[model samples]
Target: MLNQANHDTDDAAPLDMLEAYFAAHGWEHSRSDEEIVASVKGSWTTYELRALWREEDGVLQLLAFPDIKVTDDRRAGVYEAIGLVNEQLWLGHFELWSSSGTLLYRHAALVDGGEEAELSLSAAELIVDSAVDECERFYPVFQFVLWGGKSPKEALAAALIETQGEA
Candidate 1:
């Protein structure tokens, strides 16, 4: 049962760390199961939902099972992996909170022409509100955007991987 009562102020450090790791090792979103499910329903077939991606070092790391969706922003569908020209991009999307969480406050090349579409501030705000509500009573959230455009890994890594002065 996927409840909507969890997801709040997420840990910025770890998420950033993960982003860096992913940057060094490229990771991305997988394709849609909808196409296959379109023809069948209730028929149990073993399928793994993953983001078929390659590592920065040119190594292919196939994570068998992954969590990807297009539901409400707070419901984990917020982080979507769409394809654009010559690259796979992670949506400038989010999973934030009422108080605080992972809201792409300032988008820097957040969109990659075709891969990432423009998500209005209104929509972004909605995601923050909903995610905050989800984890309001529980604990803070844990967000991690794996990939995006060119040098996406590096930029994300820089954002997350803490420095001396900045947290």
Candidate 2:
């Protein structure tokens, strides 16, 4: 069980599971927030930034596929923030539903790559704060920051939710 106020767990839960999964399949990729943001800087447009679906071989796929690593301890908070940021971006009602029916409203921020990452501290905070301010405008839930670069949780959580999502 998880307390609403805090998600204090002894283990990273989904992170540990996803880490093993990625390592087994060789899909793990690591980069600081800076590296990711930089990769997408010039390429980031409104559609790209708030993409709800992914294209594979020109085929449209759900947003929840494609393994993405997320840092742990920030799971719940991060998804909550995604919703906030979505609203901020005016992307419309975006939500990701897990198989267990645990509805998670989130956004997929694809951080590209570059030197900009090494020199930008405020950009990192801006990424998070902007989401919070936007989501706070409508939803009361505090933001959850499951940073994939910082923790392995994002990939793990996504995988688990997918198992249940298909149900």
Candidate 3:
């Protein structure tokens, strides 16, 4: 008879399972005792995603950063656009580092109450997929704000356009 106490220790830690999942998917990644770092290439941004296990918070957070450096003059417009962009996001929201002008998207998947023990590779894949999708969809808006000098409304409008034609 297998004791529940014994079974608990024998199970792989949630973070370990996540690392293995990334490896099996052929994603370039490295793991530490605290977090997993991976790079995902998107349509407009190559994101450096950090997966952190917030034990106290009972959630696994994936943060993806686009490589756009906002300059001093464009901070107001960028902040304004992010405010509007975040309002429409379903899963995660974009954030800007005011001190460094770095833009990042953050999403969390809850794994509380021993949920991590049963975490599946498919679930991990889906979380990462969502992060990548958000990055791809919004990178152009950042470009439009910083480079194209578009207003918050215009930048978002241009970014949210749907295309249905052959390349």
Candidate 4:
């Protein structure tokens, strides 16, 4: 559920509200008519976040790209890793751009009342935060596959190992 505090009640566009949210958080972002691109630093890497609002479909899509680039040789392993990682995610799924071999997290939300409804600021925050959190959590798995030469299952297992107490 979205918080009601910053609900859009005026003529402000959804992306406009999102721009304000990004500004309030001091996130470096640029906004156009329907899209906003922001840079957010995660635990493992800096992520490029792109948000696109489609007014006709009442859908807002968010994509987070990690700093790592997948080469042709690593594509197969990365694809398998993405499947394993996506299975454990609830909000968004990881995708590899076939042409560029770039990995990204993608998620979409629908405005309840179609054209009559607006996306809340809290909702936007939730989407962005969730993507970053998931990226941070699973970043190591991709590395394991690409750099460590580990299988998808092995990479997932290694990344999921829980550590106890403070280091």
Candidate 5:
């Protein structure tokens, strides 16, 4: 458990806690008034994670970009694959930004103001970790659809296959 005392200051902004967590873990990150952008390395790729603190709605939103680019021809397949991937996710959902064709995972935590307004460091860690984990897990599915020329259903099925012991 993180020592809540260190984050109990009344003047602390939500992003402050996140910045602290990133610094403590030695993650390379930059912070603004309402957002923190961090680079997290995972098994498949390094993700660009952005955490935004919306004070008005008391929401902390996280977006993790896997740095995948979906060309116009592959948009339909990627969209279909996103739908299939989202169904397996119990936490965040994957989205393809239409204009940029960037695939990202998004999740949000509602902190609600007052006594519980402050976001805990552990919670911050979990949010970031979950996004990165999902991105890595489903990265191959997207690859199969976009470049391997596999249909959404076929891509999902192939990506979900698990083998027993290492060869």
Candidate 6:
């Protein structure tokens, strides 16, 4: 029997557990046996992320591909700057898809030791939210590298500086 209280579905499968979690939060989503895909609109771009339920590893892998794809000439610069950005992020990391030159954000959450019902909402929330937030926050740094001809260090510096309210 499944714990109906924690999950929206009557069954307690891993995929159902995740689907129910997202649905509870009123997030628009689609799910299959292997993965759940959700669309999130970030500050700079709209992205679609997929969360795959890895039953064998007891991991939920989440990934988001940003709208901007690096051109052939700028791949080296984008690749270098992403390393700097990845260093600062606590959860999830950005990478350029080598074949397509598309920027992607990736993360994973572990749920191996415990039962599916033990999976808290916050864990799922953290994985997805962090990916979305990072995508929105660092997108411009990549743009600066591509268009402005800014060095990785310079772009990163500008991205990290906080702005104050107008006097």
Q: Where is model 4 poorest over a 10-residue stretch in terms of lDDT?
A: 1-10
Error of 2 at 140 (Å): 4.9
Candidate achieving higher TM-score, 1 or 6: 6
Candidate 5, which ten residues in sequence have the lowest lDDT sum?
Answer: 1-10
* TM-scores of all predicted structures: 0.17, 0.26, 0.84, 0.89, 0.88, 0.83
Q: What's the C-alpha lDDT at position 119 in model 3?
A: 51
lDDT (tens digit, per residue) of candidate 1 on 65-156:
11222234433323321111013223222223334323221112222223222333333233323322322211111222332232323433
* Pairs in clash, predicted candidate 5: none
Cα lDDT tens digits for candidate 5, 50-94: 999888889999999999999998998999999999999999899
TM for candidate 1 is 0.17
Clashing residue pairs found in predicted model 6: none
Give candidate 5 misplaced runs (Cα > 4 Å): 1-13, 114-116
The number of clashing residue pairs in each candidate reads 10, 21, 0, 0, 0, 0
Candidate whose lDDT is highest? 5
User: Candidate 2 has what TM-score?
Assistant: 0.26
RMSD of each: 20.3, 18.9, 5.9, 2.8, 2.9, 4.1
Candidate 2 lDDT by residue in tens digits, 1-167: 12213323322222222232223334433323111111111111111121121222221111221122234444455465444445445432345443332322243333323211121223323433343333333222221133234222343343234233543
Compared with the true structure, all predictions reach lDDT values of 0.25, 0.30, 0.78, 0.85, 0.86, 0.78
Error of 2 at 154 (Å): 34
Better by lDDT, candidate 6 or 4: 4
Superposed by TM-score, candidate 4 places the C-alpha of residue 164 at a distance from the truth, in angstroms, of: 1.9
Q: Alpha carbon lDDT of residue 27, candidate 6? A: 65
